[model samples]
Target: MKIRCVIIDDEPFARKLLLDYCSRVPQLSVLGDFSNGLDALSFLNHNQADLIFLDIKMPGISGIDLLKTLGNRPKVIFTTAFAEYAIDGFELDAIDYLLKPFDFPRFLKAVNKAFTSFPIEKPAISLNNSPQEDFLFVKDGRDLVKVKLNDILYIKGQKDYVMFITKNRKIMSLMNMRDLEQDLIQKAFVRIHQSYIINTQHIELVASDKVRLNNEYLPVSQTYRLTFREFLEKHK
Candidate 1:
């Protein structure tokens, strides 16, 4: 599905950078640009954007302030010049917090996050909702390894290699992010960090900076921060 998005930032260069990157992403179409938060608020009344690239330290109303004022919210990815404000942005449930001078690779990571998040759309959960499946078939050296989904704690991507960490074993394979995500996503899987994908159910605890699953620690990326916060709120 195509994601309609809007850019709201004071800096001209920042807006251009976001616009250029959005052009490269076929799924994203920039519906509008606002130099100030007030203008953004006016645009919001009529425009329906699936995602927003927001600047934290803007004149007039700040990004955090605008977020609070909005009645309906699209997923937010904060872009700020100061690293100190990153924590506060996440606290407000921003999908990702991109530090200034971010590159295209980092920007791409944040955009994909909007696509995978379930909060963007959910239906009534009925008693008849199908039970979550428990396992998957993964190709091993010569045979298909029936990797129990619950047994898996995390999967790490290093260049072209994919490493699977489980309760009983660690398996390595030659794969890319797309291939791995296709095999495991929406089936007890979530990409918490840039180089890591974890089974959220196996997560023992999710701290501010890292995720503890079994005996390993995985760093959560800035882009996936909001989703992590939402994940924690489901329990509370």
Candidate 2:
């Protein structure tokens, strides 16, 4: 199946360039392109897309603001001329940030990263729904290792892999942060930053900007600060 996509940018030339790039990739199907966030928002409300190529600045609503409005946001690739917004974009877990005037090679690189999360042949790893099972298998190199839920202290995301830090050992897997976040959140795991997710049960302390888990400190990024705060309230 083709991965459905939407492009939201005020620049006609930019949108055209993205369109041209999408056409060359057989795995991508463009849902539509819009000149502003409002129009794109309207289209997205009724339609389902797997990814969005968004601009940081637009007339009606900035891309950052628009992203906040999406409850079930698709994987986003922020396209902008401004370098300052890179931090803001990543805080929201964007797939990649594309600097303006990017060539096809850079665009293709981002698309490949998107495909790693949204594979055409199969879905990412998922937790078993059975209540009795407390462990999930992770693909580490040539072997699939069984890792208990309670054993995980935290998880760290690398480019295409996540290192599962447990009390005794660390297991590496070929997984993306977004997929793992969705699966593990319900199992007492909370994403504290783009690169870190902590097992709440192991949290030793919570500071203003960081959480201490298993004698280690992990930064709580601005994007997840509110969510983590709410989690603390509910559990308290």
The 10-residue segment of model 1 with minimum total lDDT is: 120-129
Candidate no. 1 TM-score:
0.55
RMSD in Å for all candidates: 12.9, 11.5
Model 1, range 69-93, lDDT digits (tens) per residue?
A: 8888888999989999888889988
| After superposition, candidate 2 runs with Cα above 4 Å error | 122-236
- For lDDT, the strongest prediction is 2
- Model 2 reaches what TM-score against the true structure? 0.52
- Residues 1-236, candidate 2, lDDT per residue (tens digit)? 78899999999999999999888665689999999999999888899999999999899899999999987899999999999999999999999999998987578668768877864532224356678877777755435577889889999998866899998998876577887887787898889899998899999999999999888899999999999999888877
| Per-candidate TM-score against the hidden true structure | 0.55, 0.52
Which pairs of residues collide in model 1?
A: none
